[model samples]
Target: MIVTHEIPAIQTVDFTANTTYGDFRDDLVRDGYAVIKGAVSKEKAAHYVDRYHDYLEGFGLGYDRNDPSTVKEELLPVINEKGMLFHYSAIHEDFVWGMRAEPGVLKVFETIYDTEDLLVSFDAINVSFPNRKDITPNVPWPHQDQDPERPGFRCVQGLLNLLPNGDDDGGLLVLPGAHNISVEFHEQFKDEEQLYRWTNETYFFTDAGMKWLDTKGFKWVKVNADPGDLIIFLVEG
Candidate 1:
């Protein structure tokens, strides 16, 4: 059975209004993630959402935002389960890259790393329609995109919120300060080769990882953000 989670207080930083690099850095160091408020304008975010919708339309999934008659019910499971329409290659596409190179976004990263030179990651975007009775939404399991054995601040991950996230809409959940003890977690699981099949394997917290999260006071902090808000976080195991 799927377990329910209690909502925890999440930290937010206003990138467009008043937050500085120091504030961003400190919060990131403390909570392992920072929600940058208004990292992009609502208008810009809407445009990207439109592009994503167009991609879906072209996917030939028979998905019609307006009409249920056009939706291919047979394809719902495939898309919901495998996310076949969610393509990382969209990073090369205009709309996705536009957000990646967004001046405000790049500025934040530049400030955090103390460097102007940086490489943009080609990441995939998820398009989950709200209040959809047809498709079962993808429930995110707690996991880190970094390897546990390798501690300390390494590469950062970016998620540009093209749509408003919270409640039934779905959002990101973070385990605050989990980074500090990630190395120890790795040491304990080092012998489990299949678990760490890759150097930067995304460590999904099942029973063992959940125990650590619980004991360490690492609650599932929901990250809520508006369209155009970018969530940037340090890579932690």
Candidate 2:
């Protein structure tokens, strides 16, 4: 059975507004997530999408933007079970780097870190295709990216949307206000064996942790964004 949870709607910050930075920071502190609308121009985002398809088609492994049938695993680079493309040097691509260096994108990080000297994280690009019988369905993995040992905020995760991501379109789902109690949650489940053993930077919440979130009335929110928009969220302690 597919279990569904009700998520509350959230207002995204307007990037062009001069007063939204404070609101964005406030959202991060209170809700654990914030969205900046039109961080990059829509036209530029469309170009980025085209470039992304170019990268895939350049592989010459039968992947084609116009043909959905060609999106098989054999034709594409290594994509994780969650539809994340971290391999095939996707991180080093020029377009990806360009998106990272956008002024609006950098300003958000600068506002959070309070300095211009910032280093970007080598993150993955997500390419989720719906109703694909050729690929495995993405499993929902609820977890915090923060290491338990590091109690306070260390880093914020950001995603630049290249396409319209609405409710039906799969995107980020975050537990609202979960970051406030992340430290306590980790301490409570300190003895539980981690689900993901590859890295300490990620702490996968167990069934008990989900129950804990429930008790706190923290509901999962499906964060939506348009092309050229940026979504930023804390690592949840």
TM for candidate 1 is 0.78
lDDT for each of the candidates? 0.68, 0.80
Off by over 4 Å in 2: 1-21
Q: Which candidate is the best by lDDT?
A: 2
TM-score against native, each model = 0.78, 0.88
Q: What is the TM-score (0 to 1) of candidate 2?
A: 0.88
* Each candidate structure's count of clashing pairs: 0, 0
Write candidate 2's Cα lDDT for 137-221 as tens digits.
Answer: 7777887786687666667899999899999978899987777787788778899877746777788888888998899898888
lDDT of 2: 0.80
